[model samples]
Target: MVRNTLQMIAAGCGVLFVAGGAIASPAEVTVANAERRLEAGADISMTRWHVDAELILVLEKEASRKVTAYLQSRGRLRVVDVSVSINMDDRVILADFGPGFLPGPDEAEVFLHELAVTLRHYAEQAGLPIVGVDFRYQGKPLKSYYPAELAVPPRARIDARNQTALVSASHGLVRVHPALNWDYQRPDAFGFREDMITPPYGDALQRLLEERSGSGVNRARNRSQDPHPESNRPWDYMSSRYHLKTLLPDRTDIWNSLPNDTDADREVKEDIRARPLYANHLGVGTMISLHTNGHELGAIRGVEVYYHGDKPDDRPLAESVLCGMRELIRAQPGYENFPARQDASPGGHGENRIGTMPSVLVEIAYHSNAEDSVALQDPVFREASMKGVEKGVRLFREGKTCEPFVLQQIPDISLAAGTSQEITLPFAGHPQFPVTMEFTTANCSSPGACRPSKTTFDDPNTPITVLMRCRGSLTGDARWSVVLRDVDGVATAPVEFQHTCSKPGGSPAA
Candidate 1:
């Protein structure tokens, strides 16, 4: 796989040389020189800063090719392309993977780790002074994973009965790393770490396999009920067994878990445990826990934003984020029907009860449904979803309310078969700026359809017209539920329209 990746990188180098213009001397390739060229109206695309253009081109080309090849080898063909850039000020290398690179939560985590390692090795070989690697998928920025720092030996142990990995590093209190508790459920497995199932780990078994000779599936079977007898340290076990390393001490935290004894007991314990961390980390702005929902009914879909009910300060932030996600989803194509909203009830989960700061746990669409899974995989959808949360954060920080955006229901319309009827629906919000709302029909007796005359509402107070149409040979009493959504894909209460279609000779009635 490495040889093939290298060969592909070599192939890409040929293309880069042919397309990349003439290379400049090292003296002329400084950051100052690049800035001067930019000031003189040189195309930004044609300039390279603080590095030789040809070398940068070669490195980027090779990195892109190798990353794509690496993902392909892991049975992922979603990554069509990759682009790498360097930030001179931060001394960080950023790699942006094109759409479809990450199909699921599991893939996203793995791709980042693998890509980081690959880029780090290449950067080291090229004598580049990069301090960290930042990643983006489909234009949406993701968390940065820095190289682990060398730490003096820390005391660590495994609680077999509790299925927790306890690490008592010198800098902080004892941190409990729960095993296989991704959904905050009681641990059932022995070998899996909480991080392994949560964000950043990707597929822990796959990572372990990458370091070992055998297949990941086969190696995972050797899950020991306890940590290696020889290595009492958690970090040691993680490195030697799963090839995993810790992020910076400041960035790391013990996974929060509530005892399953009782609701009151769990809440009291969670408060006591979380308050200290919150108080100490006063600089921490907010917290977001990522999760996906599973339901017996496969039809459940859309994004749910949850905030602590007890924390009134977090309500606005949660609402803002919810609005942002809804608007983003609505603005994006193919996600018009995707619903994003604040959960009606405040979240009572242990993670949400972190009292020190505003916290939100986003269930990024339902993973139970087939359609939602496909939507989740789409890079555009994923990017918009994340941007919504970010926009919410920005708004919250700026003390701006996200309540300006609103959608209103249009009156029901009855239309004849093979015919169309137009009706106007009035909505009010953000009067000065244009707002776009997508009109869609769902839960129809037949396949009811509706199209808005103008999706963009330039004048907020004015009514927008929608053309409701029905087509199909056989039709009786048809009930069509119209969902009106704003740019963020947040829908107003759906308005049900009743339409009656008679035979061609018979008159249509409402």
Candidate 2:
């Protein structure tokens, strides 16, 4: 049974008083100067900006209540996807006790109440609203959310269309206006076991395996080198979480064009919206990337909100995450040893554009640190990690700006013609910060679908011209244009070149 009694989660303005009303049509709530609202005000501002990417925070936990607590705090929550990795060697010998290590009903309620209060505070400061809250703990997908009831048609299958159910007894049967069009109703949980690893992408991905195996990222990878499964890769060593083969198909599969012919970052930002973000009545959204950094590029400990040095959408999110990570990390009993920086400054001295999305790669502390190594072993760290994550999401919805991605150099310009000029532009700082430049032009006649049939940019910055030997009668003022773009972002700039076409040198076809 769920508890209905309300408790004070914060002092005065920060208290967690229940907005006593029907949650069935809960409206976006804020606490800066307004009272809690439960009205179903149409959130017209809610729109799909970028593809939703999972804010994965990895840790080993056995129903860590604290970890879950950090998640519930975010007031603008919808679907929470919580996953727990347990110590394989653990001898708990108490499987029958169920989620004993988890927070009890009272603790869960209070924890969630506190999370909501804290998140609302950040959202108010960031000038954004909150919505849904979801929990995907221990690999099992649980939620304190309902789908957009009005959006889903009655009698329509939930798998093919939108179908939502309320979590709270008071909400009754109502569907949510899913920020992204995703089916809340899934297939029966038969093969869904927590311990087993499922295919990253679904069958659609598995079918294309033979073809994707030939991609550059794979062909270029040294076959002999493989990181140990039991061990983590070095900070400098970026094991692609989106490497075509390994990433789960789910929303990421179609969103990012995984194992397919498209830019990886572009694929992530534009395609993967089904990945859960802020979920509550307000329908706020967020994106986060989790990876460990090494080599002490800067201060080693605490999670950081990493934004694209070239973009602005991720700046506010990054700042919020950095602040939350440092505070939460320093406060955790296990990780209290590491120094905390509340200012939460970002250190993305690496690339120009970070994959066309408002995202942050939280460096969850240094694996090299002896003290962090011990902290990492504790489940509380994951709790800290989740809190930092919640903060980042809240900040993004509030529209806070951290820093814009600086316009640096896109090196080794390799251009192609047909439909668009495909130039492989590599950034100045790190090789990992690679991007492609594609622009379309009337450079080719009798067009069906002309693209950079081929691209060559090993040095990256070296400007090279493309020659297309097409024998055809070319008659007209043939104009050519080059549009530089971020596949992952809508922000782009192009350069146009107008020239006369010639049919195999028929007086330059002038």
Candidate 3:
């Protein structure tokens, strides 16, 4: 019998040769110590100023080197592209495989199994977090591997897991896709189209990412084409409202004539799906689909973030980003009434669902509303919102919890003046026990008009609901604010409320 030599063997970042045909035990690879600057600002504190983006870039390179070297030594496949980054829970690798690959899907599975072992082994040696690796061949994802500890939702397939890598990388290179290039949002109340208003927010985020990276914070990469060069000039009006009439002559308005999903809508959906595909192709870890909401009811306005309900990490990702937006938007002088409206029931978003990574589509504000339209145009507001998004990702990666208290939607009230109406202000959070609620009114015609039925919530497990009674003595919109003070005497920023009242002594209306 003739004995064949081993084809490949591993030994401490070096290949070893053996005369036996049996596969060698996986090598004990040792990586060089990362740059020392990585150690200086590696603060994973509960509340941190910022993480060094340059250091993160260094780590990314190290991760890529390890994975690439191991695969290259195998001599069976080529790494077309590789993206390695830190996620909220684990390190993630997205690799595009070129030819000299396996023969079939079953073979791909076997390759993935071996790749998983190699990735975990090298990741451990480098002191990197546990890794999840997704491989793609010719634009199709092959079987991938995720660490067993990640909170995989029920029945999550290989593709879902692959997409989760993108969503879960809270600290990795984030891919931002500006609004659709072809579709135009109906003109805002001021006639400025959504295409014009929202892209700047995306641009601001891109700039913020570059600025942070430039300042040694975090590197942000955006590859989408700019759809609106005139984004900064939002005051220039182009109304799509009337143009739809050219498509539907018989219908009086686009809102009534348009189907739930038109060809145009489907095209937009496909385009949305294409973004994450491109992002995945580039090996990005996460993506934010930025947009602004529009509604026939101008009363609907605030920040909304939609996530894939089925993905375990999606909700938390959305919550974290929303918390960041709330923190910064509330800090602005005139944005006290800005609400963190409850997200549309999760899942059901093509942008969030059709990817092999975590993606969240955020409606930053409503263009249909007069006030929010102006807010969207304000550079200060744009910068604040984008910064919040940047911080939110960092916080999520660090596993830091944002605002414990999230104020849900507080609807517009049409109440009779001089009548006291009890309104339910629903809230969700894990508050420190023994928190007390305080109410205050601003821009109100009647002083001391808003009062809370219960001032204290002693249980941490109970949901927060404030039974507020407001007496409207005059016509117009008035503001009510709620402040929750914890046992430690720490108070949150006021939860601003708005209610409209009819003339005094008029019949009560909802």
Off by over 4 Å in 1: 1-282, 342-344, 404-510
Lowest lDDT sum, 10 consecutive residues, model 1, at: 164-173
Runs off by more than 4 Å, candidate 2: 1-284, 296-299, 334-337, 342-355, 398-510
My TM-score estimates for the predictions, one after another, are: 0.33, 0.26, 0.38
lDDT of 2 at 281: 16
Q: Candidate 3: RMSD over Cα atoms?
A: 23.3
Off by over 4 Å in 3: 1-185, 213-266, 342-345, 404-510
Which tens-of-lDDT digit does each residue in 1-510 have in candidate 2?
001111111111211222233221112222322311212233223311110111011111212333443445533223333342211122001111123223321123324322322322332222122331223334332221222311211211112111111000000001122332222111212222111111111111122222221111111011223542322332112222222123344634322422443322322222222222111111222224443333221223444344543344446656666655554455445454454332333222211122322445455554445555455445566555555444344434444432222223333221222122333332221111123444466564435423443333344356434543322443334344443322112112444444334444244332
- Candidate 2, 286: how far from true, in Å? 2.3
Residue 101 of model 2: what lDDT? 26
For model 2 the local lDDT of residue 52 reads 10
lDDT of 3 by residue, 385-476 (tens): 87777656655655677654555656766666665566655665533358787766766755545443338878766655654333435455
- 484 in model 3: Cα distance from truth in Å? 17
Candidate with the greatest TM-score versus the true structure: 3
Whole-model lDDT values for every prediction: 0.46, 0.30, 0.48
